[model samples]
Target: MNGRLRELSREESLRRLASVGVGRIVFTHQALPAIRPVHHLVEDDGEVVIRSHDRTALLSALDTVVAYEADSVSGDDRIGWSVIVTGVARRADGADRYRHLADPWADGEPGYVIRIRPELVAGFGLPEDNGHAP
Candidate 1:
């Protein structure tokens, strides 16, 4: 699909990601793996926007590369899926711009947004390895 890029079905991959809203946001701080659980919203342009406070550990390096991992699973039901989006991160500034696009919790105090433009997006369905389980 989508010109045969040797990837998972576009719809399937996107579905796996869209189905979940909570996941771990992995970023590098001092060259070490730093992951924080986050709630994100996916944009139409295929970008993920995560909201957080200025003091959040992940905000230390806005210029660094980041990878966000979101997954959904029901072990009792024997169903699960995970999606990883790897990209560069940058702080989203500007009131109007952020207000229209950003969704931050915690009263917007020192509010900051992390925009991740995935250069590589991988999705996996667990327990069955269906779609694109990676």
Candidate 2:
């Protein structure tokens, strides 16, 4: 058998992100770590759009670059791949323009849209590192 191992390329990274419509967005608040799972839409320019309610904690804490992780897993033996995106996040000011493009899974949230412009995208497959049988 060939012992070739394949690494995820840039194209593969974006494609996988598009395939998985959901991801957990991670940020910090007052020296505390926070993570929220959000449904997102991928743009042609490789930005991720996430809608949040008016009471969103994430929206209030975006001054610097934040790391966001989006991933999917499949296999009975628990072997899977995870894709991570690190970027700067900002709240969108143009409501009308974002409203036209943004959509929430459920209606009537009266939410604001957060934009994540990724600076780096990386992915890796799970090995038997964390107590999984090879």
Top of the candidates by TM-score? 2
**Please, what is the whole-model Cα lDDT of each candidate in the order they appear?**
0.65, 0.66
lDDT of 1 by residue, 30-130 (tens): 67778777667777777777776645587665877778887655555543566788888887764345554333345544467778887778865543545
Once fitted onto the true fold, the runs of candidate 2 whose alpha carbons sit more than 4 angstroms away are 1-6, 54-56, 75-79, 94-106, 126-134
Question: lDDT tens string, model 2, 1-134?
Answer: 12332356666676667776677788886678888776777778888777666345676546567777766555554535566778888887654555544344446444677788878988665443221222
TM-score of predicted model 2? 0.74
List where candidate 1 sits over 4 angstroms from the true fold: 1-7, 54-56, 75-79, 94-110, 127-134
lDDT of 2: 0.66
Candidate 2 clashing pairs, residues 3+ apart or interchain: none
Query: How many clashing residue pairs are found in candidate 1?
Result: 0
What TM-score against the true fold does each predicted structure earn?
0.71, 0.74
